[model samples]
Target chain A: MQIPAPFEYVRASSVDNALALLDRHGPESRVVAGGHSLLPMMKLRLARPDWLIDINDLFELDYLLVDTVPNNGRVLRIGAMTRHTTLLESDDIKRLFPIVIDAERVIADPIVRNRGTIGGSLCQADPAEDLSTVCHVLEGVAVVRGPAGERMLSMAEFHRGPYETAVAQNELLIEVRVPIRDDSGSAYEKVERRIGDWAVAAAGASVTLAADGTISHVAVGLTAVGLDRNVTEVEAVLVGQAPTEQLFVEAGRLTSLACDPLADQRGPVDYKRHLADELTRRVLRAACRRAAASISDITI
Target chain B: MQISMTINGTFVTHEVEPRVLLVHFIRDDLRLTGTHWGCDTTNCGTCVVLMDGQPVKSCTVLAAMVDGHTITTVEGLANGATLDPVQQGFMEEHGLQCGFCTPGMMLTARALLDHNPHPEPLQIREAISGQICRCTGYATIVRSIQWAAEHPAGAAPETTTSESTEQEVHA
Candidate 1:
């Protein structure tokens, strides 16, 4: 019979209303979307906020838009209230970034996905959160709205640590922006103890191939291995290199050496590092293959 | 706080604490005991109920959050004395052993079939992956969903007795 402590609940009718409520409630209030992560923590007495402002009715924040105005380049804008199930079923998202689909499939389960929002997942900032890793690898930018105004921050700046984010007490994360690249593909690989358990170790990779078969851009992000962002050292090694098995192996070695994993029931440090290396290699290989296929599709 | 929503096709309003979970609201307040509560954590699927025709874990949802939404519990699956196709499918395919997970499983099956009329076996498995059925090993549960998909209009009257016999054999 788990239950949360007594609190005040208020529903915000619109985005401005939500922001106003947040401003009025001050630091003691927390905005809840989906409530999958927050409610569980509440039940455990881990997160006992004085006020919970429900933003589920802000339908204006539930959108998926692809903008190609050329001035801002091509970018995918996902509203903060977008649910995990919506992301899983979006064909546009599947065609643009399959890594999201891969991670969403293994996030929680169909039932949790129904109400879990992408904004809530990012805001929760669990060190092992899969969407954070996927967004990090893809270089996602978060658009946050506060009482003063709106500001955009990269994934690195947005995520301060586990359960912490740049979203202030009076601010709301409004949207996530991912830059779409031509001739590029992304993939995510995870190893978990069970079907819907948190990842023992997960890796996400996005690669862009040049016309001459060289890697123009590459990034690898890991989850549950104590790393906050993508593996910049591995990305540096593969950026200008050719798409070859040898390069992937070298990248894998660098990943294994660079990550700082902890020992727990999931695995010992060594095993987690091994998974980081192997999953990194797997995602990189898949990303390169998909990148090549994208190039071919463009040429055809 | 005061909240009103449509539950089992009936409009209901209740005053509940802000921290009350939707599952508690349904079972304890509304007295819809068919929706079982298990694993206070969100990991278990026994607390699943349809929110606006989509399966959501009610244990994690605040009652106030579903203010204007429509909820479908296992009790709503049947029409008067007639059983839903999913309920019939369960009885025909012997989907339950202890019956603790049946209500949630049937509601999920109904939601899946509503969205996808004919899902593959793999799809059915994936759809119910969040739920844990400690008794039936999930094979019969998958078969039960398949049975529902085949008999969308419910089982014929003549087949009821034979299906009961088959269910008895499995039990």
Candidate 2:
């Protein structure tokens, strides 16, 4: 029978109300979206906040839209409160970013997905979190709002460390923006012990091929292997190169060498490194194939 | 804090600590013990209840968060002197051996059937993947859900022991 320590609960009526409450409560306050991740941590005494501001009623923040910026580019904007079930069911997400659908299918069971939110997953910042890797590969931007107004931060800046994020105590993550690219496709591959278990090692790849079958841009990110972000060195190896088996093999080798995996019950450090390499190759192949298909779809 | 919500179609309110989980609030406060408490962590789906017609693990939800929401527990599954089709299906298919995991399983099946009138066996299995039945009677459970799907208009509330035994022998 686990129970969280006593706390005062307040329901925020709107985004403004939530930020004001956070400002009033100061650093001891925590905002709960789905409560799937936060409540469990509270029960274990790992996170003991004196005040819990429930933002479940902030329906204004629950949206999924694709907007075209004046010159920056077209971007997919997902509200922070959007649940996993919504993401898994969205045809737009499936067609535009199959990597999200692939990872959401195995993130947790359907029951958990019904309540878990995209923002909650990001803020938790668990080393094994799949969305982090997906966002890293896609170059996600987090829009945070506070008393001082809004500021956008890249995924690299948003993630501080394990269980830490750039969201200040007086701030709330309002939305996440991912730039949509043409002639690009993304895929995520993971190796877990069981059906709903966390990944032992997961890899995500996004590839954009030029008109002549050369790689214009490519990025690879890994999960549960202690890699903070995508492997820029591997991306450099693929950029401007032809999509060949030899290039993929070299990229895999470089990925395995660059990642820092720790040994635990899941597998040995060396085994995880090997998985990082293998999964990277697998996702890159899938992504490149999808990229080619997208190109053909456009021409047709 | 004082929280009020509709449970089993009845409006109920109680003063509960913010730390109290919806599972305990249902079982202890409301005395609706049908919603079992298992693996206090969200791993087990034994404490699942329908929140606004969607299945959610009650153990992970705080009582205060469910304020003004509609909650349907196992007690609300059937009308007076009648059983829900899922209940009848369970009895006919012998879906339970221990009965501890039955309430949550039935609620999950009910929600699934509400959305998808006729779900395939694979869909049914995927819907209940979060729940852990220590009895390991998933085969019968899946069959029971399938039976309910086949008889959407509702079936006889009860089946005699001899009839079930005969069906079991044939099975």
Candidate 3:
């Protein structure tokens, strides 16, 4: 039977209480959101923290809010404790960012979805993790709260490496902020070995088209291919160009070269590189199609 | 640490080590052996139990985390003498072969039917996707859940357990 090593457990009553507990417990303490990732690691003796501060009772952090900034369009703010099931069932999330729905649908099975939280998924930061790639493509900003104050980190800044994040020993990731664009649409495409397995190779794209059918803004992010950041080279090639098969082909070529994947159980480097190129193109095409549909909705 | 929670409509409290998983707590401590423990890595759904009416892998959840919550194990599915629709459905449809995966499957089916009374075949498959049933190939299991949906109130309780109850009366 697998079991975690004995540790001290404390249930934090509120966000402030959680932060205080984290601050008090110091580096040896870890705040568990959903415990899906942490508990598994604990059982394996991979993550043996001295103290586990349970943040499951912090109901204040469980929310999804759409705030309209005076100048910066609408921003979707997801509380860190929001569960995967809640995200999957949210119509607002479905209507605003279908890419999240696409990613969540394939994140895990419905049962695991009940207990896993977005905050925990992001913090786990396994290189092949789908949500980190999705957040990267969406240009999400991680709102982190520490003893000093609150600070926001970009996806690139938040994710330092596999199984590492910017959330400090005494800090908590409070929210993820994604700016909502007017004529924008995003999509995530992934190929996994099984139903709930991590992606073999996946790509997510967010595209915004100008009134004249030219791409105004675009970001492409990849997963499981050893890329910490999105493919800016692909964005440079597609931005200001009309959505075309030729442009997507060029973007795909750039993506295949951009990612650095190692041979593992999922696939060899060549196969994954091929997936990087192909999934990139598929997501780009799908995002562009959805963007065009959004434009049509606005016009209608 | 000390933890208290409602299990199967009964309020229970116990002192457990922080490392004790909810599955072990239920089975080893509470002796609710119906909730099977399999695949400690959370891949298998045999350890599934309803946490506040949602199916969660009990193997991954810490006992302390559920200190103030309500848990429903397979033993809780039937109300007194009457079998739950899902239990009756399993009996009628022959959903189990080795019965290793039945308890979790039934609890999940019960939760699904509570949320969505009439789930499509595809929905049922998706709902139970995390669970692995090597014995019946999931065909009979799916049919079993459909039977539960069809008979939400459950047909008159008729099972070996009921017969044993009658035997006790005769004795």
Candidate 4:
């Protein structure tokens, strides 16, 4: 298939040069990192741009650093341009957070993982994206850079709505800072028709408990199946209650009740709601299992 | 746009459209017709090539993106008279039937084997999933890779995947 339309290809050697090209070209330009998602869209005539400033030469952007915090806090300093493969295969990720890394492995096929950059995916802002929900519970911070220098937005504020974000057109997401939970258990589970398709519904469940398994704090966020992401109802039922199978069931029911599923070909509204509930319960149990285990013994 | 690269161990350059795909650059522009195109979409590896020794789906990349990179096609597998071990293995094992997908299959298999010589059956399957052969199930294809890895006649590059790999560097 031929690449759609005609556009000027500006190969950038540095980030400053890239910024200058975007400044000079104005809205006529779009940045290309890996070109996994954007080029396909262009070929199908979904997103057409007059100019493409290739940032392939900007090798400095790809970095994944783990940062240590005082007593109870831990952080993952992730470069936005790092490929999904790098994250999946990273020893640091396995050490800091295995649950989060396992969730990333089921993203797409290997080639897509090797080429699709983290920043590019987040910038696309698909509602059903898996990483966004992980960010929701992990309470991550997104570092963005642009013509206006650099700024950081919390995960909560960064994702505004479906296919929407607080990021400006001129800005590029530089890095994502993700928090690590020591006592808390975290798990992400997603459902799709087949591999390579976007998620129909994704849920990230995090729960911290007392020494006796009594729930301390809880966060459950669902994406794709819902318009606006709201987890207050589920968290309310989960925080005070002990993380047993029964409580997880209630949380899943509450979360599913909050979703307004649109009737579509994929599944009926009720069917999707049922799936939302089941997936929520399953993922919550998995997360709770991880959380109840000792921090040093966190596996899977 | 003008793009130049080594094709079949010879320096070749040609003017192409900015949107021209690398597979087309290899087949139509440079006339190294050994590289075949099956599925234009990247899901099929029939248009795969050794671009800088990586088995990339040439159909998915723009010729302009790899102007100065070293490239290799099926025609470059042999040295004058002797066929590379992989080529000999394919013929001996009946690794091809219609033969349309063999070139891309061999190139992809070669790229993988060059990186990890003793690949397990599962790994070989993953590498070749991009290439679809209507006939001659991947059993023989995997055997061909295994055979080549076991017996290398110094025809192929010794070890590649970066600065060290290009014994036939032409740009």
Relative to the true structure, how large is the alpha-carbon lDDT of every model? Answer: 0.91, 0.90, 0.90, 0.74
Question: Clashing residue pairs in candidate 4, if any?
Answer: A185-A291, B45-B130
Which residue pairs collide in model 2, if any? none
* Candidate 1: residue B11 Cα off by (Å): 0.8
User: Per-prediction TM-score, please?
Assistant: 0.96, 0.95, 0.95, 0.83
Candidate 1 ranges with C-alpha deviation above 4 Å? A69-72, A297-300, B157-171
Q: What share of the true interface contacts does candidate 2 keep?
A: 0.89
Candidate 3, residue A108: how far the Cα is off, in Å = 1.5
Off by over 4 Å in 3: A70-72, A297-300, B157-171
Tens-digit lDDT string for candidate 2 (B1-171): 899999988999899999999999999999999999998998879899999999999999999999999999999988765677789899889999999888999999999998898999999999999898888569999999999887664564345754454334322
Summarize candidate 3's per-residue lDDT along A136-219 as a digit string, tens digits: 999998999988999889999999999989888888999999889878889998999999988999999999989987899999
lDDT minimum window of 10 residues, candidate 4 chain A: A291-300
Q: Is the docking of candidate 4 incorrect, acceptable, medium or high quality?
A: acceptable
Q: Per-residue CA lDDT of candidate 4, range B37-155, in tens?
A: 76666665677788778667777677777767787888887766667667877877788888888888888777777778778888877677656777877788888877766656434
- Alpha carbon deviation, residue B53, candidate 4 (Å): 3.7
Expressed as tens digits, the lDDT of each residue in A152-241 for candidate 1 is 899999999888899999999999999999889899989999999999999999999899878999999999999998899987789888
Model 2 chain A worst lDDT window (10 residues):
A291-300
Q: Which pairs, if any, clash in model 3?
A: none
How far is B142's C-alpha from truth in model 2 (Å)? 1.3
For candidate 2, report its TM-score.
0.95
Question: Alpha carbon lDDT of residue A90, candidate 2?
Answer: 94
For the candidates in turn, chain A alone yields TM-scores of 0.97, 0.97, 0.97, 0.91
Ranking by DockQ: 1, 3, 2, 4
